[model samples]
Target chain A: MSHMEFTGKTVRDAIAKACEELEVDEALLDVEVLEESARGFLGLVGHRNARVRVRKRDVLKEVLEVERPDSRYTNIKPQEFSEIESFSKSGLEDGKITQEGALSENIDKSEIVSQAKEFLEGILCRIPVEAAVEVSVVNGSIELEITGDRSGLLIGKRGQTLDALQYILNKSINRETPLEEKTEIIVDTEDYRRRKQEILRDMALRMSQKAKKSLMPAALNPMPANERRIIHMILSEDKEVYTKSYGEGPLRRIIVYPRKAMPNKRRRR
Target chain B: MKELVEFIAKSLVDYPDEVNVSEKETEIGLILELNVAQSDLGRIIGKHGRTAKAIRTVLNSASTKRKQKVSLEIIE
Candidate 1:
């Protein structure tokens, strides 16, 4: 057993110094200040006193473990395969899922869930956007909730981009999952995709009306490939108007051009 | 044993460019340091670290071939 104490001007300084001396991850340890740094007279001499307790041996053991591996095990931890198997069986005991159920039957549910989450996160991180994507396991399916501006880029038209992501995640998980386990996965972004479709339809009507009034072509801002497709599909029936998608790749957008004279893009019930 | 673990770790991380592996020789076995980009550290570790454990599982299986013990750590 071991302990230590220190006095400093502030808790932050004391903790930082302790971390420097400890040579361990700061997150792993806890810190507390017993008293405030005393500023006596003209802030010249008195300082705060604090206490720090460290798991020196445990931490040292971890460092040494990282520094050197136990040669006897040859760097492998003894695995209890039967224990994992039993855990899987318990999930099936509820009868909601079977041991033979799709991919879930043969694999560890927790393990597969984790892989799916990480794999999806990687895809989102690559996209340069302020929005965030969160993955959840709901009813044995993967649900991706996206929050940000221009979320249509992620959902795509008819959920194509979302589909592609699901396909990629499925492939990655299977490759990593043990051979004996089978787990099926799905991904969705809340109701963002559905709501976007409605909004696009409304936009199409508004643009057609403007074109009819102005009797000149109007161009909307650039959108992702999927959303652009939706705009085109929505306006295809308007005899008085036409739609075109410009730009390239993911940034491409739709432009709705109205005929020289028309009442308006009719409201479709 | 060390080389194989490093190869897999590198492949699993999005920032493969940032993957680094160090081997420590011990009296009983060996310790492996798997460091990756702070941004990519989560991907390697996975949600709740399930993916990280899976990677360790693969490393363990490979280690079995050489009759040795091995463990993996994710350095942020």
Candidate 2:
């Protein structure tokens, strides 16, 4: 962390200078205005004093390494998921799968196998039969398409079970990624996750159209905030339909209403 | 107001046995008081009072349908 004191006409200009000097993202830094810039009647002198707490990104690299021992794995790309999915699907169709197939196949097939194995083990640990679960990383994220037999446990308890697994994996993987390129982890099961995203996107589009046609408000079934964000992002540009989130918690839903209807009223209120 | 309070309390509280509602209908509007088991209060309130506000919003919407004014109060 570095602190800089500077004088400028405006806070923005002073921050810009500090950012240039610190080489950090301005949004990430904490800024406080010590004193407002003053102007003299003669226009010869105006004094402004500002204190900026600059975040040094490099310092984070050191701290993150300490936080995540396996920081070397990061920057997994989205395209890799598709490739792994296809590879596993083709391999399964071909009727030839190795004990551990291609990296992509391994990544895609691992979760289902693991969940099934865990379930069976929990039930049959006392029995003679033994269950095994193994997962390989192909392009760092599991491919949804190639994954198989996950609809059962993956969709358990209204997706609470899946969400828990995803949360754990994401935390672990994010920690595994190196500090230089640390990123959030995203986990998927079967093609359900992608399909859900598509469904939400389509619903947003349909609701936008419906709101336009009927000139009425349409309330969608409640969903988590992430899903709501997806809908909001998709229809944000529409001229006719405006979106508002309603309800609460995991079941919180989105309302698509005609922009012309009750334009001035706050949606939640 | 009493009916509305009963409906809300019955729906929100997990321990329906302990659900209770008291109503005071004033000249201007209706005030509905809600009480439930301590264990079930969090479920009714939800994170940041979002669930409670949502329930109130729904109540408000329904109130409009009847052309009557009513408010909800959740007793801690």
Best by lDDT: 1
Residues A31-81 of candidate 2: C-alpha lDDT, one tens digit per residue: 766666665556665543443434434443353242221111112232233
Q: Which runs of model 1 end up more than 4 angstroms from their true locations?
A: A1-186, A249-251, A260-269, B1-76
- Model 2: fraction of native contacts: 0.00
Residues A125-179, model 1: lDDT tens digits:
4343355666666555556666663535555545655655555455466655453
Our model 2 lands, by Cα RMSD against the true structure, at 20.2
DockQ each: 0.01, 0.01
